[model samples]
Target: MEKEFVVIGLGRFGGSIVRELNKLDIDVMAIDSDEARVNEYADIATHAVIADSTDETVLKSLGIRNFDHVVVAIGDNIQASILTTLILKDLGVAKVTAKAQNDYHAKVLDKIGADTVIHPERDMGRRLAHKLSNSSIMDYLELADEHSIVEIIAGPKLEGMSLLDLDLRANYGLNIIAIKRNGHITVSPDPGEYIQRGDILIVIGHDNDLGRFESKLEDN
Candidate 1:
């Protein structure tokens, strides 16, 4: 079956998701209480409706439960977003992702059973800091409280070895999840994939191990 997604609050975050999902060929239903906002995504989503999601009857009428994923991106109106998430959870929506306005809002969403809660602004800030602090880090993502995935530009030390020779998992306890060469990405690269000077390694491991790897790379 084709995946179906519901985007609540047709604001920037929700609207962006709707457009991107449509580009991926996924079915998207965009919902917003604001008629103008709903109309904006009408050409991008499979369906766009102006209806207050905080109203349980309205949510039910939208067949929200049929959606495989629902994203709550309501801004300003925390009560409505929280209420909508609660209703979606109670209705057994398979997955619910919510955008938090602040720490308190995030906590409330967590308590109400939001499967994933994101602070896009805060995350972007952290990512920018990570990039600025380390010249070698191309990108970074916090996967969990104690784990992260980072893409680091390969330096001089790794220019001559094949992935098999590096044996990151056995030697450094890190996983080379992907490699960015030139402008292309090689996902789950083969053991024989040779490393070049300009390659960027997308590695995932414990935070401590990643730190150790970065330190070692810098020294080399």
Candidate 2:
């Protein structure tokens, strides 16, 4: 079955979602107050409506509640985004995802019952900070405020240690979720598998503990 999506606010984020979903052959209802933006996505989406999403009557008229998911992507107007999400939920939309400007905004969205919240700018800034802080860290993702998943090259200290020998879970509470070696990936490798000097480890765990594990690699 094709998944149906209603993307409110045809700004950069909303526009990107509309294009990508349409590319994947999913049905999308694109909404925006700006005529130019609505025209831009008219052919790309299943339906394009130039209307104010915050107005409950206009949204109801467009049958937005029928969509499987509704994404509120109002960039400049947080109030409009919040109100749109609230109306969608009240109208019994299946799911609502909102883009938030900051931590406070995310909290407000959560309090208002947003099914999911995205802080793209904050996430990007954190990744940039991680790269600056540790030249060896290539990528990072926060699973929670305290925990994260990171991709880092095996440094000198961990050159030839096997998974069992490291006993990562007992020693540091970190899990080696996967290993990328020689352009290939090993998911959930056996305990006896040996970690090579240049192998890349995709690990997940608490931030402080992961930092400790990285420092241990430096010590070895």
Candidate 2: global Cα-lDDT? 0.88
- lDDT per residue for candidate 2 within 1-220, as digits (tens), equals 7778989889888999999999899999999999999999999999999999888899889888887899999998988888888888899998999999887888888888899999878888888887777756779898867899988888666778999998889999999999999999999989899889788889899999988976765562
Query: What TM-score does structure 1 among the candidates reach?
Result: 0.85
For each candidate, give its TM-score against the true structure: 0.85, 0.91
lDDT of 1 by residue, 1-220 (tens): 8889999988778888998999899989999989999889889999999998988899899899999999999987999989999999999999999999999999999999999999988888878887887778888898868799998998788898999999999988999999999899999999999999989999999989988887777773
Best by lDDT: 1
Scored by CA lDDT, what does every candidate get?
A: 0.91, 0.88
Q: Lowest summed lDDT over 10 consecutive residues: which window, candidate 1? A: 211-220
After superposition, which runs of candidate 2 have C-alpha atoms over 4 Å from their true positions? Answer: 215-220
Candidate 2 Cα deviation (angstroms), residue 5: 1.0
| Candidate 1 segments exceeding 4 Å error | 161-173, 182-194, 215-220
